[model samples]
Target: MSNRAKLFGALSLGACLLWFRAAAEVPPETVGQVAELPPMAGAHWLWVPDRLFRHSILFDGDSGRMLGAIDSGVQITPKPPLWSHARKEIYNVDTIYSRGHRGERKDFVVIYDSRTLNVKGEVEVPPRAADTGTGIALVGLLDGDRFLVVLNQSPGTSVSVIDLENRRHVGEAQTAGCAGVFPAGPTRFGMLCGDGTALTVHLTENGELDRLARSKPFFDVIDDPVTEKGVRDGSTWWFASFEGLLYEVDFSGNAPAPKEPWPLFTENEIESGWRIGGAQHLAYHRKTKRLYSIVHEGGPGSHKDPGTEIWVYDVPSRNKIDTFSAPNLIAPFLGPQAGFDATGMLGSFLSFVLPNMGVHSLTVTQDERPLLFVRHSDLGAVGVLDALSGEHLRDIDEAGLSGALLVVP
Candidate 1:
């Protein structure tokens, strides 16, 4: 071979080897990449990433100035997979978590002063064999020394009495089978049972278990009226279940039960080509009493009714006022493992993280302003949305943070 030909052949072989290396680096079936991590902790009181793990958030209504972040700490299980943290919600407290001692098999509800962000004290739920933690999704700060802890989970699938003054163990009473507990009136509580039932319970002045009432919650569908449910303005209880049925259960029982639940936009009306589950996302305007529920459609490789639509229902009339498609609503696209890239706020007014798009935490502020905060699961971003204008507000990216968003009052 000529010297020039030999040199050219050597260079071509080198180039081919480099190309092979590059091609081998990428698997043919590879589609997604390891996304960047979410925001870290420590910043203005604005939104602490560590503050939301398996927790919840609630804005103090009376003051309306401070915000609360609650989370239950990590628990021990037969395996790490079985260990799950208790969901904490911010109300008049911060750092309120249910710490489970694996050795002792006990779950203690710890409350922290939001201002100091310090552990105020702890309240132990009724002692159990399995160390079932505080499954309290919704905790209402009624006044000083009293708060309502709703446990929708086992061991504590009832109401927990917490005495802030003493800051110690208190009594617990079995409400309905499931958690979904909300306050209806002073000393009275509302709970949605897992058995497609809603019951009202009255409490003693000193925070003792009182009586239970069977409510005639208005709904259109009798076969399955209870879909997904929540309490509105602490006065009316709303449930979305069985197709697009949306029903409002008045705690006062002043309103008559509806022959059927008002339809929030049927699946056919939306042309979603999917069965829409009733209980998607339920959030109520604190003062206005307007209720919002996300009517979602699930896609392939997704849970049944993965939530493709958001429905808004009027409390007074029990009617569907508006509906938005899932695609239009911002949400993170999940990879095969059901994860997404950690994309920060696209813009100040755009979504930072999409709502879990499946039974996520989405709530509008009590103020007249239409600001709404939604917790997106794919990326674990807390999304802020403009409810009135239906615009995407900035998002607070808090993936791998300390807690999960509970409720925002």
Candidate 2:
């Protein structure tokens, strides 16, 4: 070969290698980009978290647009963000782990500015009992959002009271054997006990535990237990039992006065296997005084199953006013296969063999035109429905948003 041809060939090979190296070295963008979002009027925030990334995302319920996010640091599991109406601050409770020691961990209530989403302050919460991860109400605001209550489960169950105004952890209240924190009154909260009673804790002006009391055993805990995720409106709380019974408890006074347990489903409906289900199955529209529950056709041990229908009830009359069918409950099974796609056929077959895919949680937006945000865990989708008309608006599917606890501010 000629010397010129050999030199040309060598140069070409070198250039090709350089180009390939440059292409390979190009970097991918970060998994989650932290961008400031413009404020939307009447917007509600959704607690969509990528558990793998240890960050909780706040999404706009109206447009399914991501408003902002908070980094919970490495190996941290953050509770749902609590919005303070009076203080205009967002509070998040997270279990932060130490960098060097895997066992070393600390709990912190991180506060953020409502408008800017900036970290305002962080108060360290002492370690207490952990919970079952059933998406229970772990954090609550009392005294017109001036104080914060966090449920702890370090084997020994108790609640940590945080003085948000003072930005300090005041004290802890012994909940006896009860779990979960439920706002009962202006300066009081309640916890569901294992023995079917609710232990109510009252707070003083300084956010200290003033006293504690327990209600009479209202529901059967073992055979048919009430869910911890009850819907509260004013001083009344609607708790649903495993067998589809609604126990209304009025906390207007010192003790939790229980009303008669009303059957959520009639005898005929029960015969057809209609039951209340889901982690966060029930939601209440306070302004409209409507109660919404996710229901499905399942037998005794199917409380965790996704719901096929949403039953709306008038809170005052305790009568069913409307029902909305949830078609997305099985839409994931069909996939992209129209009729004869092999993969789609396989998906459908597997779906039938597997458990039902339905709504896992429900929340009503605090907007003028309130929309119901339904979270489907198995499909990793959120469906928006008209609160009054029960019209399915749209579905938002994003990866890593599964099993997210919904919060409306």
- Candidate 1 residues 101-193, lDDT tens each? 234344555555443344555566643312222222345544232554534345556666665555654567776464555566656666665
Note the residue pairs that clash in candidate 2.
Answer: 128-154, 129-152, 129-153, 129-154, 130-153, 130-154
Query: Where is the poorest 10-residue window by lDDT in model 2?
Result: 333-342
Against the correct fold, how does model 1 do in TM-score? 0.62
Question: Over 4 Å off in model 1, which ranges?
Answer: 1-71, 75-101, 128-145, 152-157, 176-179, 194-196, 216-225, 253-260, 270-280, 286-289, 298-305, 317-319, 323-359, 399-406
Candidate 1 Cα deviation (angstroms), residue 87: 22
lDDT per model vs. reference: 0.45, 0.73
For model 1, what is the error of residue 221's alpha carbon versus the real structure, in angstroms, after optimal superposition? 11
**What tens-digit string does per-residue lDDT give for candidate 2 at 1-409?**
3323533443353354445542234367678655554444245656665555557677766676766777764433446777776677888777755764366788888998877889989999886526344446777887588788988877778899898888999998877688878887657987788988877788888888898878899898889998887898877888999999899888767777888988889999999999998778999988888889999888998888768689999978889999987645333322321222213554446445543445767888655688888876544557778889999776544524345467776
